[model samples]
Target: MAGMDEAVAELAAEHGDLDALLAGLADDRWLLPTPAEGWDIRDQVSHLADTNDICVDTITGGPRPLNEEALKFPTPEAFTQSGVDKGRAMTPAAVLDWWRTSAARNRDVLLQKDARDRVPWGLGMSAKMMATARMMETWAHAGDVRGALGMEPSATPRLRGIAFLTLRAVPYALSYAKVEQPAGTLRADLTYNGETWPIGPDDADNVITGDALEFCRLGIRRASRAQTSTLKAQGALAEAALDNLRAFL
Candidate 1:
């Protein structure tokens, strides 16, 4: 069984990787725009740190709203926009330092509790669910950082496991994309650790096959569907699925 310790460790390792990457970036590069709409690198890092604070608050307390209105804004986009606007005034070094400190605090909080503790998220989830969501967010934003800096991201089995779990939330993604698949099974052949984990047996006539990372990337729309060499999909469900891809619930 996956324990809290394992999740915490994975979170910490990914946080460390983020820290190292941010630390190496030049100050000017921090202002570079990323694929995430209006966010620059500095804004992205600060947003991540801020998200950690929000997560810590949720885990330690009862329930909290994950959206900006609940956070006193009209939308998450507004909140992130505000963060970016504020972050633009700070130096890149300051942003990276803040992220490091905030991530450490968040890690401490998660490490102190069991994985099953209840925590409130925008979509109604427990602490474990929130943690998994954060893991996915980290990976996605990290991909943004890597892409902006022309850096290649290294994949780990631990990260892949998290991705696998997050990908299971495809129905949520489908809802967000406003795309639905026909009643049928879709087989996903995922390769990791010299083995394969078949993710689905949906009754749809579609199948999506690829390396774990590539599949995760495509499912999240982080990597263009055309860029994936390992993916093979058949039937109308495959194309429809690609059209409505989303990484978050």
Candidate 2:
């Protein structure tokens, strides 16, 4: 809750960067494929728009039924594809409008809530946690958009929220993998903006130190544990955590 102010600001900045990235596109460009296989620009935005509605609903006390049919799919990727296929009927303009409006309202509603209030997120999380999750999603998918446009991602202090959340979620990640917590407390000695940002228990032997973007990439599953040489670890839990971490649920 303490970083709520900075987290909200960074979320806004992320959306702004996305807007700048998608400023102009020929109609054909909107139809082009992105890094998410089987998804084009419209599908990517459509997914974001759909989730925006869910975010709003969570805060507004109007929960909708999860798509049971989609849940029947064997994998999360398949579940997503089912929705993206149905969303194909939306013209790009309509999808873009929905996303823009929902994102705006999302900011407004969250700004009015107390940090401790529960938001019906993945499994009931704090308002600040929800906002941080939104930032993670926004930044992760924004990469797909950039890939489609052949542009490099630019970093900002906004990543601070994502990095913090990634480190904090380590315990949950261990549970998700059903792995026993390694024998000691954990620590993250990450560096962002040329300054080291140390977090977690000080006496812990587990340490993960690296570039913020690369660590963020690991959480988003965009990069593998073996591929991120920039990420260094010094304990059992740290090694396993790096391999199994997730920024997105």
Which residues of candidate 1, in runs, are more than 4 Å off? Answer: 62-71, 184-187, 200-207, 234-240
**lDDT of candidates 1 onward, in order:** 0.70, 0.78
Give the TM-score comparing model 1 with the true structure, all chains together.
0.83
How big is the positional error of residue 173 in model 2, measured in Å on the Cα after superposition? Answer: 2.2
Per lDDT, the best of the predicted structures is 2
lDDT of 1 by residue, 123-165 (tens): 6665555666677778778878887788765577755655555
Runs in model 2 with CA error above 4 Å? 1-5, 65-75
lDDT at residue 168 of model 1 (Cα atoms): 61
Task: Find the number of clashing residue pairs for candidate 1.
Answer: 6
Cα misplacement distance, residue 195 of candidate 1 (Å) = 3.4
Residue 125 accuracy (lDDT) in model 1? 61
**Residue pairs that clash (backbone atoms under 3 angstroms), model 1:** 184-202, 184-203, 184-204, 185-202, 185-203, 185-204
Model 2 clash pairs are 219-247
* Local accuracy of candidate 2 as per-residue lDDT tens digits, 1-249: 344675577778888887776666666787889988878888887787777776777787655423433357798777667657656887777777877887887777778777888875655678888888888888888888888989765567767678778887877788888888787777787777788877788888888889888888888877888888789989898988897898666
